[model samples]
Target: MHSQYKSRQGHTTLGNTKTTVAAPSWISDFKEITKMRLSISVVFSSLVGYLLGVDVIDFKILGLLALGGYFMVGASNGFNQIIEKDLDALMERTKNRPVPSGRMSVNTAFIISSIFTVLGIIILYSINKQTAMFGAISIFLYTCAYTPLKTKTPLAVFVGAIPGAIPFMLGWVAATDDFGIEPGTLFALQFFWQFPHFWAIGWFLYEDYKKAGFFMLPTGKQDKGTAVQTIMYTIWTILISIIPVFGFTGTLQLSIVAAILVFAVGIWMLYYAIRLFKLMSVKAARQLMIVSVSYITLVQIIYVVDKFIR
Candidate 1:
């Protein structure tokens, strides 16, 4: 639900035109508005960071972190839809969202988001001040900065990556209650990974995006420059992912064995990136997108497993 769907006036889910073929129920609408699954994935990233930083798990902290992270991301998504309801209405993939499709009022969405913002901050504050600060900043940067920049410039991806990258490091801060090279390393890994992941998504949806005036590609089109940057970022992502093996990342240590495993996935992702560069087709981009998800998820799992066994 990073940047999702649009509207068709005078409709209640069109069945999601019902992608259920039956108008989405209120329960379904709630899920759609909050972008529930996407929010959960982001929460999982924060938990992974917490695991890397903590020597012993604290269930209280873990539960709080998950709740706070979900509220924060869900709120961001809700506000994003409110702002882009019209733009979302213009895209086929987004047209069924509640706000733009007349299933919910804008004011209602705003209230829910505002409540989430307050509740998310409070929950994070219960953990520690540093965690709370980062949570607020993530929300502000996403909704205030990144959300608006989507249609203004392709560099919106750069801006968006800021909030997108925070959950990983935020968990570290929650665990260690410190900001240092350890969390910085985690942030850098996620930060660079987003470029290729998001770009591939942009490539395949370039046409749909243009309908809403979105400039997702670096050059604003499917071209050599975009492909080259994809490869470049993929390389950067690989470099950062393996850096923990050097043992300079403090608490965020990666064993040589784990680093090898991480490198293998990075190369796997890189191959797809190169294919995208050579082929420059939507199909190639789609393949890269799928591999990138696996690459990131696998590398993180390796880090967490290495942390426990090493």
Candidate 2:
């Protein structure tokens, strides 16, 4: 506290007061509730897929897809937080989230989630019936199936992967309003990539996740078996990534050089996965997580550039 008093010669004096300014609590609360960075990154994947699928890109549709994607992902995360408020408070990583930290009421979070879900579907439906259908399904599966199962089974990763992988192919669906081998290949790429990506995260955050009773790893531990499956999925990711170079993905075809570049990054990621398996350390797991993120982005970039050039 501070007080001001009149000084001699009618001068005003102030004592022991300073001000600290921060973003409004509501602003920070919104960002945390939506997991804004993650939602944007998810939208980026969808945009990449849209670019690959479109012959002539429509900027309007692209914008709508981004908005809709963000809303849907945000809604899912919000609902997850609402359901796991207590669980999130139990884990170091998630304890500061809005619902868990008491920065926002659960009812408020639920309303935000429900609104986003509806608006996301309506925006997506403006694009195409198929796109909206997928968005709705993604929201339903993620909140209904994935969130509740997180603490119940190690297979939650498998369940979570379905909605996680949808964003990429959802863009293709947004572009063409069709479902076929093209979007399927894109879906497969993301689907396999998540196993290694998330398993590495699971390994590194094992203790924290255990505090919340989250069985993220396939075998529910950071062991050789989980590492081995990480390897298997990483291999599958690489195979699916390179398949376009063989001229089998229809409109999703890639140049041999792009495929080679993709393969190089995949092997780079695999090297880290092997290190995680051998070292069995959080350090190695963290490195694998970083590489897996880079691998997906690099490969997606390679595919998009290859598509435009060819």
Candidate 3:
């Protein structure tokens, strides 16, 4: 009888230990539903934009911008997962996410996302009206237009790029308190960069995305058509990067040396795109993705440095 009691007690202890270990893992699972890494990247872009926008740095505004940008980007990402949770369950890459994996309730996710949406907008309002409006617009477009369109058509990439480009341009407005040629220039640069960046992502994730019913590429199949179009857009991206060299785009001018350097990076990226177009293999697609990342980061650095040095 004592042996039986001891066995039962041991079982109960193990059960409790299991429960305790599961709890924190569950909370972490919930956080992963928001695509935290992607939001971090978005916040980084916003921070860089904010830094480049202002002549003098104000840590206070930077704090507000970071806080507000995180929530805004987080909310956008959370709602994106909520809307796509069902679809995510079908994709290998996304099937383990909190919502799709049943670690977090969809309703709970929605409520948290909604809360962040409002909080983010209010915080941005504290910075400037233009910033607030831009933040709100980004949320709306990402959730409303980009989220749904992903399953419906390939044009979703184009639609999503608008909001994606806004963060960099947003800083110019946040600092200058107005929309002018400078912001427009910033907008143009980021806008053109998105095509190559996102297309490379789409290309690399094409198989996983197809499982989720997302036709991300213009070709709608992992084929030469898509690769060709990606190369075309990359060429356009390179062209736009050098535009400010002419000094015709208002105060957003780039020096010949800066343009040459920026143009070299662009060509390097385009070379990868060209390789993808020729090879049409996953290896080439992966290289294009790497080059695309390098391209954007380098271009932004060049723009900010040129602004200061020249």
Candidate 4:
């Protein structure tokens, strides 16, 4: 009987040991740390630029551009997290992030970020010198300048928009190795789009941002002034988005039909921005945010489709 009990005890102990040895979920943790969804969205913008610029659509170059864009954005995000870990811990939305939540050490995060930065620059460099240079600049501006500036002043949004706009133009540069009116137009579209999108986020997350002392909204409050600025920038975004149809953007020309479609979408976005100005409520801001995202995505789709159809 005692021998039988010893065998059962051994089995239970083995089961306990097996249960205690949990496997590391490095992939999921890495995704959270790098903000994979946001990185993917940025990569999509670069791919859109590449698709618009490339004549023959080389899948190999396209793949490299997407990969390089993701790595660069990922590295920027990781570095941003490391620098803002303490501040992030104070914010409800960011408190659960890998660095702030103690799921990942800063040293490990830094090492991973370094690897991503090196790989990203090399991948972009393989495409072209200009692409690599812009990739590096995007990372530098995002991590070094925009990340810290969030707490200092609302103007960080403008600074942040520089790197934010780079991906859209980077694809064009990757394809042509040139920065001309075409890429400039792409940069301008994205640069203006960020204001409304970011301000909408700032409006709704005012309290959360306040927890960490981040002054994201213009006027540093969700007042009529901020809403008015959001409206003004939305108008600017709409105006510039249709300028390609006027034939000034060279190879980046848009058909009149595409221009009309883009304008319609812009109008839809503007309606929400106007409503936000009138209502000045969180709901209106949220609606504006959703419409703004749809507007950009639809505009990009229209641009690419217009290219192929034409």
Candidate with maximal TM-score: 4
Q: C-alpha displacement of 176 in model 1, angstroms? A: 1.1
Which stretches of candidate 3 lie above 4 Å from their native place?
1-27
lDDT of each: 0.92, 0.90, 0.81, 0.92
Residue pairs whose backbone atoms clash in candidate 3: none
Q: What range of 10 consecutive residues in model 2 has the weakest lDDT sum?
A: 1-10
Backbone clashes in candidate 3 total 0
List the candidate 4 regions with Cα displacement exceeding 4 Å. 1-24
Off by over 4 Å in 2: 1-23
Q: Rank the candidates by TM-score, best first.
A: 4, 2, 1, 3
Q: Write the per-residue lDDT of candidate 1 for residues 1-310, one digit (tens) a residue.
A: 2122223223455433445323445556778788998899899999999999998999999999999999999999999999999999999988888898877899999999999999999999999999999999999999999999999999999999999999999999999899999999999999999999999999999999999999999999999999999999999999999998897888678899999999999999999999999999999999999999889899989999999999
Give a tens-digit lDDT track for model 2, residues 77-119. 9999999999999999988787887867999999999999999
Worst 10 residues of 4 by lDDT: 1-10
RMSD of each: 4.6, 6.2, 6.1, 6.6
Ten residues in sequence with the least summed lDDT for candidate 3: 1-10
Give the per-residue lDDT of model 4 (tens digit) for 1-310.
2223323432333444663111234555688778998999899999999999989998999999999999999999999999999999998888877789786899999999999999999999999999999999999999999999999999999999999999999999999999999999999999999999999999998999999999999999989999999999999999999999999999999999999999999999999999999999998998899889889999999999999999
Tens digit per residue, CA lDDT, model 3, 1-310 = 2223323432333444653334455456545755666777777677777766788988888888888888888898889999998899999888877788776798988988999999999988998999999999999999999999999999998889888888887776777677777777777777877776777878888889988889788878778888888888888888888888997777567899999999999999989988988888877888888878778888888887888887
